[model samples]
Target chain A: MNAATLARTRGSLVGRPRGAGHVLETLAAWALALLWLLPLVYAFWTAFHPTEYSTHFSLSAPWTFDNIVHAWHAAPFARYFVNTVILVTMVLAAQLVLVTLAAYAFARYTFPGRDVAFALVLVQLMIMPDVLIVENYRTISALGLKDTILAIGLPYMASAFGIFLLRQTFKTVPRELDEAARVEGCTPLQTLWKVYVPLARPTYLAYALVSVSYHWNNFLWPLIVTNSVETRPVTVGLQVFSATDQGIDWAIITAATLLSVAPLLLAFLLFQRQFVQSFMRAGIR
Target chain B: MTRSREWLHAWLLLLPACVLLVLFTHFPAVANLWHSFYSTPKGARPARFIGLDNYRALVDDPIFWQALQNNALYALGTIPLSIALALLMAVWVNGRIRGKGFLRLAFFTPTVLPMIAVANIWLFFYTPEYGLIEQVTKGLGFASHNWLGSKSTALACLMVVAVWKEAGFFMIFYVAALQAMSPQLAEAAAIEGASRWYFFRRVTFPLLMPTTLFVLVNAIINAFRLVDHVVVMTRGGPDNATSLLLYYIYEIGFRFWDPAYAAALTMVLLVVLGAVAIAQFVFLERRTHYQ
Candidate 1:
């Protein structure tokens, strides 16, 4: 400890110590955090305040649901919300099934090019689904999936992160369980379905949450693939709201922005701890 | 009889994802390479093959080169700022305190929300007339400036927003790494009279290298892919001031209907991303060797 901190902790009267470094670091961090969150807080402020006050910040502005109400009537928000849910659910469901099966295979059964194939599979992380927009756009078009909901999701269903996460999680499972299952006449698939999947629940949850957040916020691929209102996800819908040649209205745009973020924000707030842990587990493995 | 069938069944279990990967990812990559040399004729029966001609034109395309430079500048700007902010926040959140969860969640909240959503909202913050930023600035008696309108300021403004959106998510990784550290080392250092700064610099920072490398790769990847903000907020505006490489690719391939040339640009991007991925693996291997 420095003399300042030492003096504070030791209660020295003449040469009083202070936790100067500690206080300085803590203050800087907190200030930087609030500064970092300024835009979010700005959004939050704008979302809650009434229109006409949208451009201006006022401490005592008259608050109303007018912007949200105007925003609700302005677009097919309910439909957009439903579509986002369905899209996230469909993608996550497929990822869970496919990644679990593949992860189990790579983890338990050693096969030819197993390492190479796994490494190749990880190439998806470096080259995102967005990067191959030309090819995915072509691939989706070829699959006769243009402008459909599934077109927006089909490429992402085989998630590299999903597979990698589950593989790591499965590696942590004890070998004895596999042996015991094999001795008990459990086939490999059954051993995987019964023992490994259940054992990797936290990881499953983590990857699922990550995938959902990822796809929910995903816009570019969805933008290129989905065409009309019937299949549009929330982000695309929000984009189309302001993507016009005419002068854009700040109130309506902010309202639409608020609508897009509300659901995931609500979800994050509710599952705050698990949501935080989920990201950590993803990074750790 | 069933023993050999079991091996086949194991392959069967992997078929769904394997097929999807091959069809969507692997084939498209090959096709992107293949299609980069051809132009689809509007009324003709087939695409005209022009080998290396499109790439030759790309080398001379000033717009493409400018966008590429902007992308590099963007990558350089966002990577270090986000990484530094993330580490700083991770240290703060990792400290012994009440409501660390709340603080961490606050920091991470942006990662979960739509980037386009936040970008649309932040657009107002960068707006010129009656925007929040302008209001703040004009209120201070300084002449107001369009934050996203000027070529010089627009890209930097976007980078600030990007780092804000990304840093906290990166911090979670560092926090996890910090928490995973054995507390005994810190206590030993404390007994030997290491201050918090000293403890962090000497003991804590070196130990967090793995997480730092992971965050570095992820941050770079995120910097490239997250053009949703550009699409929503600036749309590569004010003379393509904030035109990033991905957005440039979108403009060239899709907007300009020159997929042949766009594919060449994407090849450049693929090389960049591949290099980073290789560097990450090298970092991992080196760390393992050191351990």
Candidate 2:
């Protein structure tokens, strides 16, 4: 080989080491990923197969939907699913409207005590309704919303994180858009609805995904507030179903676990890219 | 006239959110502090102002102290490990890896699944004998360990679960941060004969400190906030070994029906979270960046 060709080949070897170490690292990564996924895989396995096969990995184990059928009959899963769907939808809807109005005020109009009001709003970021369960429970009951789906969604309806995120997104919208809408005879609310809201659609989407995921998975407050099957969300419902009093049937519990998580999991699988990108865009770690 | 009208409109817009915020977060926070000083009313007894009695009770309560210590240890253990593992995961996935999508999905799946539901599955993993963990250890000729049963291992078992659940979520953030980084930094480091380890240690880590702090804050809050797994898997059991602060507070507030003492416990949580919130604000305000 010529000197220049020799140098080029040598440089490639110097910079890029395709050695056993790289291979080992890749294997280690894959191993850990597999390990990370093992629990869910096991859940699916146990849920599909017989109870005897739950702890054992048997290739000969016959698959059946018996566990799922038993689990479904064992509890009001369909009702729980409905309650969860309604809870998340109610919470998300309320949050959108409230945060939109509040975010608009914060983003555009500067009224008296705006700074103080904003500071007060930010206080919710630290002391969430989840943390103040004792008193909030009292407040919910006082409002006579006890054991209701409304109570589960009420405290979180005004999300500080949602307001903060939307305001940030709103602040980035150009003055020209708002001004152009105003010049076109739109009211302030009209300008927000038509110009600002549309411009911040991506932010809205991000916040919605984050909100939905959070409330859907939220447990403690719902566990406290909702007592009856009529109002209990899936998280609470699953806990009640799988409690130790039922004697820990792994197959049935796994089936119910799969059932409870299936909607969100299915959505995540289908829209994995958006779910991840929304989280990144939403700036929530 | 228009200016006053504008002010009215702004207040009108802010009303609903502000009212809900006050009712849920602000009012309850203050009320929790206020009520902690009083005696919780029993059936026929009215609540009486017993100044510092509840705090005194909290101080004397061994379970409270145990919960506090366990929580401190839990936070300390889970935070650094998760954050470090997250950074490591991000680095691996961001590089020349095959099946990046599958790896990312695997890492992130737990975040999407509810902790309560997943804890039930992990509960099976930690089950004593003929359980997944036991089966593995037995196959390896080791003793069948009660991963979540024995007092010595229960908290650690919960910590492992928390770390597994959180590290992946944090990885997404780190991944985002790493991707946003200019690739030229790595090229320059490689040109300077910097080993990958050395480069990550000296260059990548320092640049990612802000994200690290953000993730750290989140991990801290979550350490306190998320006791759902504890509720499911352990119930602070085998003598409250796995009882976290929040779980204890829940027991005190709800199960035991001692809202006053629970309020006291909550004050402790609030104080810690408040400090964290302040730190976050200070850090964000500084907007620390690197060259």
Candidate 3:
């Protein structure tokens, strides 16, 4: 105990002794941060500097916002921005109802084939609808929801991840709470509404945030389902904007790229801690 | 109400999602497996069943071989580097860092951004001239080079970008796992004259085993699932060097409009994913049993 106290006292004076391993580890960490920031750094440099100055990073170089104006004038990013918001909201709204009801069932019921049915739904998690584009396309074409926001949102409405997450949350609610509500002469549905749904509020919020971010970044499904610029999401539009055969204009492309990610970036900046916590609580890696 | 009625209502609630999953996911996977065996002539109605022909054809197909090699290389390259880097970042952020929140936000922001957006940014970074890399290289008097335009370097560049985008997301998981661990263990080790490296490797790392395994499986899966950057940034171009397995499947299924061949290739992918699933369960099962 005395030795422990002595070490604790000296710990602040002499920092953790330098080691080959720690040196390597710190270098590796900085390397990773650099790697993640490489594109952003490049983009920032290009965005600030002119075309001639973009190639050479002299400290006395000139910089301008010509790229931003160029990119802004090239497309109606505002419309794409609104479309993404609508798509995320539409999908999340439908998912809450479908996943909540499905979760309540799995959590509360002891039905035949419950396990198998739940597993079936979860296959969507592994083999996403985007992979089955040929079939999904046929389905969308048949529904006549093609080239519309509804089509972009439809396949994602019944989310397996939401169902699984909600089920886990619902199961944590104590049995006695449900029993008390039922004994108060409430119906089964009424008990669920009063006791269970309210209890699972945090899980609901976490799932909604995850679902919203997911749909906001979703690309391939929206790409295939929508053709017209009027209905396209940010991802599809960005792809088209950047893929000109003449090759990308680095400064303007970075500006456009930054514009595309601005919303989620702002939201995440505002709720960075909560966003990190949500992933932790969700047990997602 | 009664127990039986409650059960019925439960099924009723589950019915809609179950049906949709069945049609879109489960049924399609099964149908894809079936379709892999048949031949549908272009512009014809009836299809002829040819068992093993498609799979055999895939064996001889050079692009299939290239794609398989690329994906295996991709999984091999990205998983260990990113996971190790993620562990490092987590350990650092878990330490007494002054700007942990800001650093975490910077690390994680790319993941929330659409891949296409990131691809565009990286496109500028990999630009033949006037991009940051070329600028830096040329400033130092080295010859400026195209990072993604060449077949030799494109996949490596893609792997680097991929590790960048994903490492933070993985780091967040490890940080949570590390934070949830009691500080007592590390403190005890410090008193015993144990170095920080020893403490981390011997005590902290062992405690984080379950999380490491979890992250490993996820990182492996993401290695396969995410080739969007490849598709957008490189288009698997320059002699198909960056032609990853899934993108090749996309090309076959959507661009080439040959769903049968794509189905066969997807079967191969399913087999690969199944192997990963087995590793996760088997490794975890053995660890638990030993414990």
TM-score of each: 0.94, 0.95, 0.91
Task: Find the 10 residues in a row with the least total lDDT in model 2 chain B.
Answer: B282-291
RMSD of each: 4.1, 3.7, 3.5
True contacts kept of each: 0.59, 0.72, 0.51
After TM-score superposition, what is the CA distance of residue B223 in candidate 2 from its true location, in Å?
Answer: 0.3
For candidate 1, the per-residue lDDT at B242 reads 90
Q: Model 1 clash tally?
A: 5
Residue by residue across A1-285, what tens digits does model 1's lDDT show?
786565344322211114775567666766776776677777767767876677666788987777787777777888888888899999989889999998887777756667888887888888877898987887777779899888888888888888888888889899999899999999777888888989999998888888889989899988888888889998888888767624646666676787788888888899888888888888786
User: Taking candidate 2, what TM-score does its chain B reach relative to the real chain B?
Assistant: 0.96
TM-score of candidate 3's A chain against the true A chain: 0.87
Give the backbone clash total of model 2: 0
Model 1 lDDT per residue over B160-209, tens place: 88888888889888988876776557546656776666777887788888
Best by TM-score: 2
Docking class of 3: acceptable
Whole-model Cα lDDT per candidate?
0.81, 0.89, 0.78
lDDT of candidate 3 over A46-152, digit per residue (tens): 77778666556688877788887888779878788888988888888889888988998999888888898887776666667766666676577887888999988
Candidate 3 or 2, higher lDDT: 2
When 2 and 3 are scored with DockQ, the better candidate is 2
Candidate closer to the true structure by TM-score (higher is better), 2 or 3: 2
Model 2 per-residue lDDT at B246: 95
